[model samples]
Target: RQHNLRIKVARIFNTYGPRMHPNDGRVVSNFVVQALKGEAITLYGEGNQTRSFCYVDDLVEAFLRFMATGDEVTGPINLGNPGEFTIRELAEKVVALTGSKSKIEFRPLPQDDPRQRQPNIAKAREILGWEPTIALDYGLKKTIAYFDGLLRAGDGDLARLAAQ
Candidate 1:
C-alpha cells in the first residue's frame, strides 16, 4: 500500500509437461529423459522425499484465473496439486510408462533438499476456485511421450549429457 500499487503472488510448486527443457536437472525432466533413453534413474537419499507435481497446462490455467481476480483478492496463494508422491514412486511410474528397463540407482541425498514438499492450496481453492485436475500418471505419460520424441529427433545427445 505504501507504493500504491496492486500486487498479487502465486507460489508455484513443481510443474512438468511438454516443452520442458530436456536437461533442466529437475526431477520430472530427469526421470522422464532417463527412462526414455533406457538409462538408470538416479535417486538421491532414499528417494522417499515427497513432492506434488502440477501439469504446466493446469498451472497456466491457475495463472489466468488468479490474474482475473479482483484487486481486493491480493494474495500469496499456493498454486500446486496437493496429490503428493515419493520420488521413488515418480521414477517407477516413468519407467513403467515408458517401458524402459532402467533400474533405480540411489545416492546420498543432496544437502538441503527437503524430505517432503507439498502445497496447502486451501487459499487457492477458496479464492480462485482452482485445483489441479491432472493426475501424475497422466501427466507423466505425456512428459514421457514428449521426451521420447525429443530423443528420437536427434536430441539424444542432450539427454545423454543430462545423465552424466
Candidate 2:
C-alpha cells in the first residue's frame, strides 16, 4: 500500500507442454524424453509422491484472465491443475504414450523431496474466474509429439544432450 501499485502474484505449480527442452530436468520432461528414447523412466523413492500438472495453454489463459481483472483483484493466487497423480503413474503414462519399452528405474528420493504437491485454486476461481481446462492425458500427448519431432529432427542429438 506504500506506493499503491497494482501487482499480481501467482504461485504456479508444475506446468508442461510443447517447447519444453528434452533435458529440462523437470519430472514431466524427464520422463517423456527418457521414454521416447527407450531409456529407463527414473522414479525416485517408491514413486508414490503425487503432483498436480497444469498444461501451458491453460496457464497462459489464466494469466490473461488475471491481467484483465481490476486493480482490486491483486492476488497471491495458486494456479495449477488440482488433479494429482503419483510419480509412477506419470512414468507409466509416458511409456504408454510413447510406445516405448523403457523400464521403470527406482532411485533414492532426494532428502528434501515433498511427498505431495497440489494447489488449492479456490481463490483463483473466486478472484480471476480461472481453472485449468486441459487434462493431463491430452497435454502429455501433445508434449510427447513435440519431443518426438525434435528427436527425429536432430537424429537423436537431443537425446545425447539429455544423456550428458
Candidate 3:
C-alpha cells in the first residue's frame, strides 16, 4: 500500500452484473451459477448479511469522474449502490431470475463476516455527481440472460467450472 502519488476515489463494496464466475466465492456469482446448474444455493451464516451492489458501468463512470476531478478532490469515496440487500434476498432473486427450481441452503457462517454492510455514497454524489443508475432487478435479469445463453450453448461446463 504505497501512499505516494495522487490517488483519488476509493471505491468500496462494488458488485456487478455479468461476467461473474459461475462458482466463484462471491455471493452473487455463486448464487447465480448454482441456480443455473440446478444446484442448491448455499449461503454462509444466517443469510442476513447485507451488501451493496454497484453496476459495472457505474463503477467505470465513477473512476472516470474521479480521474477528472480537480486535484482538490482527494478521496476514498465509496462508489457503490447505497441500496442494501440481505444474503437470502439476493439468493431468492437469483433463483427467480434463472427460473431455476434450486433450493436455498445454508452452511456455517464464516468467521468475521459482517452481518450488515452498505456503503455510504454521499461523498460520491456530492463530489463527483456520480450515482448507480442500474436497478438490482434489471441487472439481475441481464446477468441471468447471460447465464442462460451460456447454458444453452453447451458452454455451461466451462462457465460452471470457471465460476467455481
Each candidate's lDDT (Cα)?
0.89, 0.91, 0.82
**Over 4 Å off in model 2, which ranges?**
1-4, 159-164
Q: Which residue pairs in model 1 clash with each other?
A: 45-109
Could you tell which candidate, 1 or 2, scores higher by TM-score?
2
lDDT of 3 by residue, 72-156 (tens): 7888888889999998999999998888999998899988998887889899999999989999989888878776766777756
Native-vs-model 3 lDDT? 0.82
What is candidate 2's lDDT per residue for 1-164, written digit by digit as tens? 89978898889999999888776789999998899889998999999999999999999999999889888877888999999999999999999989999999999999999999999999999988889989999999999998888787766877564353
In angstroms, the error of model 3 at 120 is 0.8
Best by lDDT: 2
lDDT of 3 at 117: 79
Stretches of candidate 1 exceeding 4 Å from the true structure: 1-3, 159-164
Q: Candidate 3's error at 9, in angstroms? A: 3.8
Error of 2 at 4 (Å): 4.7
